[model samples]
Every structure is written in C-alpha cells, then in structure tokens.
Target: MTATAATAATVLPIRGRLRPLGLGDVRITGGFWAERQEVNAVATLAHIEHWLEREGWIRNFDLAVRGGLAQERRGREFSDSEVYKYLEALAWEIGRNGDAGLESRFRAVVRRVAAAQEPDGYLNTKFGRSGQAPRWSDLEWGHELYCVGHLLQAAVARARTRPGADDGLLEVARRAADNVCETFGPDGIDGLCGHAGIEAALVEFARTTDDDRYLAQAALFVDRRGHGRLSDVEFGREYFQDEQPVRQATVLRGHAVRANYLAAGAVDVAVEQKDAGLLDAVRNQWQNAVTRRTYITGGQGSRHQDEAFGGDWVLPPDRAYSETCAGIGSVMVAWRLLLADGDPRYADLIERTLFNVVATSPSADGRSFFYANTLHRREVGTLPDADRPSLRAAASLRAPWFEVSCCPTNVARTLASLTAYVATSDDDGLQLHQYMPGTIEHRRADGRELRVTVTADYPTTGRSGYVSRATKLPATLMFLGRCRCGYPDGRPRARR
Candidate 1:
C-alpha cells in the first residue's frame, strides 16, 4: 500500500496561514491514534458500505437516474449527505491504505452520485418526486443545499486525495456549484438554508476550482446567518443560527452541528476575505464556547430537545446531547481556526475533542458508534429504542448504528482523515499538534520536500519524541513539558 499523505487539493481560502501535509504523507502508523484510524479503515468503512447499500442510498441514486423516485427515497431528506460523507471517508481511506477494492468502490459510488444529478445541476432524491417536496422550495427544512454542500465536499475530497479518479464527481460538483450560485445568493434567490453546512462547502469548492463565484456565495451565506431571515423553526431562529449576523455573534448558539459548521465556514470566509471584525468575532465565539459551553470531555450541546447549545456556562453532563457529529464539527472548526490564526489553543481543543468525544464515540473495535455522547452517566443503561436494545445511548458506550445513522459515518470520515489535523507547515517548519506516532511529509512547489517522524506516544507510555529529515533546511524543535503541555490522562484547559 502506498503511504499517501493527507493534503488538501486547495485549501486556498486559508493557504496564507499554514499548509497541511498530504494524506499518506503524515501516517499514524502506530500507538493509540493509529489503531483507531486502522479500525476506521478496516471495520467502520467496510461496515458503512453495507449500511449505505442496505439503507438504499446507493439504490436511490440508481432509481433517480431512471427518474423512478423509488421507495428507497423513503429515508430522511438529508440521506444524500450521509452518502456524501461516506464517500469523503472513502477518499481519505483510499489515500491512507490505497486499498484497490476500496478505490473501485469509490469510483462506483462517484458514478452513481453523478448519475443522480439533474441537467440543471440540481441533485436531491427528496425532491422532484410525485409526492415529495418541491425542489429547493423550503429553505427551512429542505436540505437540498445541505446535500449539495456534502456533495461538493465529497467531490473536493475525491479531487484532493484521489486525483487520478477523473470521474464526474468533480465536474458534478462544479455543475452543482454553478447551479447553487445561479439559484441562491444576492443576485439570485437571496435566501439561506436554515442549515449551516453549504457555506463551508461553497468556500471549499471555491478553493478547489479557483472560482470567485463560489467564494462570494460562501461569504453571502456566512453574512446571512443570525439575521432572522429564517422563520424561527424548531428551536427558534437560533436553532438555524439565523438569530444574528455571523460577525456580531460572540457565542455559538443554535443546533450544535449547524452552529459549529457555520462557524468553521465563517472562519474560512474571514481568513480569505481578511475580514478582521468577522475573524475576531468567530475567535471570540470559539473562546466563549471552550470556556463556558464545552464539557470536561470536550463535548458540546447541552440539550437533547433540539440538539442545540445552552446558555453560557449552562453545561449539564448528565443530560448532554453532545452528538458525535457535533464533536466532529467542533474539530473541523478548531482545525480551521488553527490554520487561520496559528493558535496553539485550537490545536488543544482539537486534541481534546479527538481524544475524549470522538475517540469514545466508536467502540473498542470500531464496529459500533455513538450518536449522542455524554460525559456523565447517571445510570449504566442501554438505549430503549425498540429495535436496538443492545445499543448504548450516552457515556463511553456505543451502538453499531442508529436510525439517523449520521454519527457512525461521520466518525468514519473523521477517523479516516484524522492525519490532516495532526500537523501543519509554513515556510519555516512544521508544527505538531496532537502527540501521535506518525511520519509527516511536505512537498513544496519548488521541488523541495521535508519528512518528519513523530515518536510522540505520551498516550500510553508517558513519553514524547520528534525527528525531522530534510534535504537543505534544518527543522527546529520546541519540546513542551508534560506539566506545561499536559499528561495524556488529563484534559488540558482551553485558554480564554
């Protein structure tokens, strides 16, 4: 298998900050983190293929190609998001292990996803059917843009990590993005999806294609948040993060995943546009979240009622609804923040969320996962869902899957692509964030390359190490002590 490093095809929005090593370049070859990723690749990725097929996502694409609109579309409106997320995971797994079968599956899914697209670049199985919701009709609950966001993300993942697979996924993404740009934004619909995912997706799509339209679209979406443009559905306008403008918000309110995903995209927008006020607002919101909203285990979302955030410092461990997807979203936001400002604080939060919330979501063998993750368990109990009695709902335990099933695939993609968050490099040298045993390689456009091996295994052995190999440049080391940096057993405090 090729040791493919994890690098973005184009993190253009924040390229000025620090560049990441490619997928196989930084490999978690051993120790605790490595084992988790290994399980994700072998067990979780394989299991999700079965789940997607069994759940009829793959079949829905086939039906949509024939314009049949089969019963397979019976799943949630955002079922396509799950499929796209799974493909993103597959992209990184292909880079990680270079499994030929997985690569073949990746191509197959790409073809299927492309086949599901309409000529107008509109894609979503939940719409266009006889009895289904009209296309892009409801911005509040319809997830057309959200699905498109995930599709663009999957395409970006494929283009970045699997450059050779010139299948229509990338083109499909471009067409879909063109449709989005033409359909929404200031010159078009002037409407925003209640969900916050499409903003980051458009920004990433802009990075991938070097097109300003998508970037402008991303900025428009980011700016549209918190304006009460939404109809205050479910948990009020705050649930959709439309209560205030992104630049004015000092804390993340609303559904956890939507809020964090929006915050992440806002970081991208702020970094690319060099919007100081917006950037500062996002930074302040992150600080507030870490200090006041986040749990000891690095989880967010104190309420199960809406899967949304509570007031400042309103964290309740026993009733925590810190969905695994939210934890992943938190890491996504943290990583972008890490790139935006070159802050060690972002790295600490990513490490904390990774070790506690994300790591605990998957069971010991990675065969099962958790949807709702809690820090405190009042009683050791299994989920009372009639169909899944063996599945645990909260705390450290996990379930094989859920009816919603977002968390399992989210974990799959996250763990498969975990190396991207491990280290970053600028013109000077690379900065190691989490203490994982791995080999990180960086390739410069001027034909220079640097490779470093981290023997940092403080998780199990309470020791850390690093060594770098370069051709002409010498890499310097900054060793942080256990007391200062931290012991692996304890959670580090986030700076305000």
Candidate 2:
C-alpha cells in the first residue's frame, strides 16, 4: 500500500464495520473543537515542548547519546514516552497544516532520538546504562517497553502524515519494533510491560508496515498478559492486568489507563485476527465500565492512591482520580469499537469524554492543565504554583506542569488529531460521530460523492445541526440541502 493509504487515519483496521476518515477527509472549519485544535497547534504544542525541554525530558535523548545517562537523566522512567507523544502530536499537527516550523522541530527531535538508539535498535534513556539497571530487568516498573510503545505510535503518526518523508522516524520505529519482536517473540521473553500501551502500538506498527511479525508480537503480548508474567505488586496481579487473559475479562479493571489500553489493543488484535470472542469480551468490558466505573464527565479511575479504578459503584465525586490520560485511553477504546461495530453508543461516550474530560484538561489559553479531573471540589482549593511543577494528582488548580506529567502531552496529541475522530465513511454513506462545525467529504464504495457541512454549539448554548449535500444518496442515507436536528421539543426541525 502507498503511504497515503496507510497513514490516512489513526486507527485503520484492515476490515471493520466502518472505515474511519483520515485527517485529510474531515475539516473542522470552526467550533469548540476547532478552537481547541487551534490552541493546541499554537499554544499547547509549544507549551508542551517548552516543558519537555525545561524538564529535560527531551534532553534525555541527548544524554543517552552522551555518557552518564544514569547521573544526568531527569524525570520519571516513563519521561521518554512524553517526548514521543509530543512528537506524535506534532506529526498530526504538521499533517493537518503543513507548518514548516513544526516540521523542522519534529525532524530535530527525531534526530536526537535516533542518535540515542543502540546498535541493536534498543532505545531508552531510563535503563541499561553505566549506573542504571540493566534493560528489561525491571519489567514491573521499568517502562522500557512502554517508552517503545510511544515511540512506535509517534512513528505511526509520522508515517501516516508524511509517509516517506526523510525524517527517519519511521526507520527508527521500525528498528525498535524489530528489536522488540526479536526479544519478545514467542521464542523470547515471556514478559509484557507493566504498562499496556505497547500491545496496541505494536499492532499499529504492523498495519503501517504491512508486517505480520509485529502483529503477531502484539497478539503474543496480549495473550501473555493475565498469566502472572510480571511479579505481583502491592496493587496485585490485576494491577498489571496479569490476573486473567484478555478474552476472559468481563469488565475493565486495574489501573484505568492500563485497562483501557489493554482493551483497545485487544480489540485491534481481535479485529485483525477475526477473533469474534475476543472482540465480544472487550465490548462487554467496555459496556460494564461505562455503566458502572465511569464518571458523569466520562472519566475513569476513581481510586487516587494507585491511579486505578475502584470496584463497581465506587465512584466518589470529591475523590475522582479521573486522570486525563485515562480519559484519552477510554476514547481510544470507544473509537475503535465504534469503527468495528458501528455503534452509536460508542460515539455518544466518545462525544461525552472528548467534550468533558479531554477538553477539560487544557486550560482556555492552553497553558496549564488538569492532571486529575474531579466532578466535585470539596474545599476552596489552592492554585498550583505556575513556576513549580505539582506533585499532587488531584491538584485543585490546573498546573503548568507536573512531576510525572503525562496528561498534557496526551491531550496535545488527541486534540491535534481530533479531526480524525469526527467522522467516518462506510460502504453505504457517511457517519458523523462527533458533532462540530466542519465539512466532511467522502466517496462511497459505489462511487457516490457525499459532502456535508456541520454547524453546532453543542454542550454549550445555541442549536446544533448539519447541512448535507450529496451527488447520489445511498439507500440508508438520503438527505440533501439545509437540515437542522437536535432542536427543542417545539422548534422547527429538519432531518439531518
């Protein structure tokens, strides 16, 4: 396949119930999401880059190239993943708008990261150094594979956006993926990352490169989980998702982000391998989580101590640990399942999560961010110090930065590529999942052109509607000219 075909959308399953539209297909002309996308492109992306540099997370790659990484490396063990997520955000932003400056910055970061890669494709600054612990020695918390997962995702973004561009990010990702397959294949380590990101990422890399090996590796990782691969922690085996296999879990458990990522990856594997039972298992898990574990804001992870989900109905408004990353993870799972099953409920949850949780993370100007989104604030909370990074997760104020910052970069990437999640086209007609002021254009399987303009002030004030025009209508989609839906009980309504 050509680069254009493969890198069109974020989640492109080989065969799904609906085909997702790429960043190139939908255009957010104006609206809340449009404003957020602009802020992300202008402010949040730069704000994240400033902090990554200021915090020396990006420089960790440079330190990895130089000696004394153990002494000089700053930030948490998973800090490298933030830089990669920023790169992913940049790649999508650059793809959305061919910004020459962002492209330059993207290439520069990729170069520094590429230089740090070992001769054998091992890439990380947190492990396997002079004074640092050996690589893969701390599977439960090392986050080496987790970092690689983000790296592969960044490469997926770059490949989808720029294709054969000379950035070398795709090559870097390929080498690292190859190394992973070599080291973690069925013949190799029987371990998985403490974190669950690498599973879905490996599946995506495989799709991008049309390589079965990476897909098989992803499946192996998924299968190997829930079998006591990693040593148990205080949070127990379930915290690492080592308690049961993916196909058997009825509901999402453990760390909210990890559960969501694992479910999303499992869906990818199920769809690719045509495992109906596995797909059903994930759908069941998602249904249960949304019904019980989710917050009204569409956020998850109620337990603040371990950053995990409490038992069913354990949600407390005042103590919601609804980490922004977990919100993003839930969207990932929902979006994929929506594509796979063509379920409007999935889209509904996605709309809720994007509007409340994801959008709530970044401040208005896109400078500060909320790491944990609470439904209720008990006290007149203290504002986080703008100059100093906050160590607290449930900080009352949106901090400029955090000690283990993940949400800001995650939000950046999600918003930068938010257009991809807006709409999708199937064999018959177009489906606009998320309402926004935008234009969607697509040709159906039978070659009928469908173009629609959507206008809405949703989750806010004013009316929401879409005006669709089509060359030829499919049987299921027969609408044209001006239309207005979602009106009040007595307002003049037009079918959309």
Candidate 3:
C-alpha cells in the first residue's frame, strides 16, 4: 500500500473517481453472457468485416482514396461510421484474444483509412469527392461530424488496447479531430452537427491525448445546440436535439439516438467542466425519458418516420423504431453518468438495454442482425430467404445486410467491449453492476489489490442464485431507476 504502488496501478475511465472494470480487468470464464462474447469474437468479428466489404463500405474507402465518387457512393451517407464501429469491435476482440489474423486485418484497414484521408485532415467518403456534396457543406444531414466521432472512438480504442500498432490510425484520428476544431466553432462554421455524436468523441479525444482543444470543441458543440442552428431541418427544431440546449431540455425528445448521444456527451462535458447544472439537467431528462417514453424492453424510439421519440406515455410496442444503435447509445450515456458520481442507478438501464434490446439484435450465429428491435409481433410472415423475414421494426429474421447497416456493427462493438460495464471501485471497495458469472480484478485507490470471482444465472428467472469470492463482497447494485420493475405470475413491483 505504498504511494508508488498506488500510482503504478492501472486506472479506469474518469481518473480517481470509482473505476469501471475494464475489458482486461474482468474475465468471463464461462456462462450465457460469456457464450455471447465468444460468438462475438469467433462469428461476429469476421462476419461484420465481410458484410462491410460486400456491402461496399470498404469499397467506399477505396474510392475515397482515389479522390472521386465515380460509383456515386453505394450505401447511406453515414456508411463510414459502420467501418469505424467495426474497427472498434476489432480492437476489443484483439484485446480479448490476441488474434494475429485480426490484427493484420486491422492494420490493413488502418492503412487504407490513412490513404483515404484528405490533405486538410477532412474525411468522409461521401463528401469532397466528385459528384458528391462538398466537405462539411451539408451539416444538417451530412453526418460528417458523426463519422468523425466514431473514428475518434475507434482510434482511442486502438491506442489503448493495441500499444504496438504504431500504424498511424491514432494520428489519422488526431489530424481529423484538429480539423474539426478548426472548422466548426465561433469564428468557423458557427454551428454544431445535426447529430450529437461528435461532442462525446471530442471529450474522449481530449481524455486520450491530453489535448484541451478537443475538450473545448466538445464544450462548444454541447453549448451550440438549441440555438436554432439546425432549426430548419426535416423534423423541425426537435430532430437533432436542437430543440433546446442540454442544460434546459426537460425530456429526451426527437431522434432517439441523437437525444441519447447528446445527453451522454453533455454528461461528459458536465463532468469535465464541473458544471452541476448541466449534469442535473441530463439526469432529469434521463428520468423523464425512461419513465414515460421508454418501452418495457428498454427500447427508446417509438416512431420510424424520423427514427425519433414520441410523447410521454406514447410508447407503443408494435410501432416502435427502437434502433439497436439507440440501445447502445443508452448504455454509453448511462455508463458515463455511473462513472460521474458512482451511482448504481445508471447501471439499471444499461443492463435492461443490454439484455433486451442489444442482446436481441443479433441472432445466435451472428451472421445477421436487427436494425430496429420490436417488442411484440402480431404475425411472423414467411420469406424466400429464411434469414430475412418481414416484420415490424426490422425483419422478423435478423437480415444479413441493410440499406442502413448501422445496428450490426454497433452490436458488435458493444458486445466486444461488454466487460467495461460490469464492475467499479470506490475508495472503500468494489461495486457489481451486472451479475453475469465472471472474474474481476482491481486495485483500490489505496493500493490494495482485490480479485473477485462471480457465479450467477442472470436474466433467467430470478437472480437469487448468485455468489462471489473476494476480499470484500461488493454490494449487489441492482438497476432500479426511472422505470418500473416486475416479475411474471402476477407480482408487479415498481422501483422507487
């Protein structure tokens, strides 16, 4: 318990606060959850890369490297985000299992991404190419900054997990981030993105590189919303969290993923700036969203038209547009808030979304995925392709590909990085967020080392059979916040 020993201990996110157990910090030896992650590595990691290439996302990168869009961009505007997300999955999968094959594939993709970067550090295959929109020109729906955000996240993951990469992916991210800082600001474009992803990524970029410019940019974007900058969009003021600033919004409104992602970034900004008002505002909005708007399966959006949220108490199960990506966004937001103050409540929704929405998105084989998760199905129709059934939200069967293929990669990355959500450390001891059977290791702030072995059957029947072996047992932190809790056979209990 010496000072040197404490300083030598590895730290988790949000330094000196309670440390959330990282991927390496906890090992899932075996169980249901462990099976899923193993499949994510063996089945999902390679499958998604194949889908990206066959779906033309990797081709888009190649075409961008040639400085033209002669093919007119095969997929959606935000297609590049899928590539970045898949790279993130690769980073974690490599961390879990030192797959030389995947590492080689990762490096190759990084080189290709480097070749695609513009001289000025701008990236986004859909822009700056011939017969396409100019760089950052269509901020309202361009998704230029959104793509930048995912790339930054992937870069940070690579740098953290793969130390010897040195393949320039981190530098590509840094240069791109610097370009964003220069382009959008007070004296620059004077507007933030129509999407809310970049703010969180900028803050994370600052944390990873020790750069204040990224933090400032994150704050700039956080404050820039709700000032009518993106008011003229398709969904009016509410579409992209531009309806009101983060500190003033009472409930999560408009696009489900956008609202959740922006709220998450707002929490990161508030934590860094020590702005309690902003933090309180985000917490308040989270309360309202979960209680009145969210579905029983922890899904967010209720409409497909704008892929947006509906009014309070308007959550209809069958008509839900609960994008799998939104479920991932909810986990990201809740995890940050949990790290902010060591509150066990944030872990509640993370578990709900993880089990019900995210876990359900992919099938057992991981060859296909669900774009939007629906709770109920009136009729399960037959299809020519058994893997691709027609149903509400997404296909009844998990389709191998989609015109908008965001969810598949999102699910991949989330499952690949699942352990980071499992446990945490306070000065006193550890806290268990999810009860999956696993092994966890942590060094307390005081330099005391503890290793925990957990055994439990989670998300099946009641959570009564659970056991742990450690220096001290962590309080079983149940996720009971902003929503109702219930059990079948006629016992319905609401959380207080």
Instruction: Report lDDT (CA) for all predictions.
Output: 0.78, 0.87, 0.78
Off by over 4 Å in 2: 5-7, 392-394, 444-447, 474-496
For candidate 3, the C-alpha RMSD (Å) to the true structure equals 4.5
Clashes of each: 15, 2, 1
Tens-digit per-residue lDDT, 1-496, candidate 1:
1112345432434455766665756778899988888888888888888878877877888888776674547567788888999998998788777899898888898888888788998888888766666777888888889889988888888777776566778898899899989988677887888788988888888877678799899999888777787786757888998888888888988899999999989988888888889889999999999899999778999988888899988988788888888999999888888788777777778877888889988888787777787777877765444234232253236666566778888888888878777777778766777778888777765768888777866677657676767845555333332245532224453322
Q: What's model 3's lDDT at 311?
A: 93
Question: For residues 262-317, what per-residue lDDT tens digits would candidate 3 score against the true structure?
Answer: 99888888888888999999989988998999998889998898888999999887
Each candidate structure's TM-score, on Cα atoms with residue i matched to residue i, is 0.92, 0.95, 0.90
Error of 3 at 363 (Å): 0.7
Candidate 3 residue runs with Cα over 4 Å from true position: 1-17, 382-396, 461-496
Best by TM-score: 2
143: Cα error in model 2, Å: 0.6
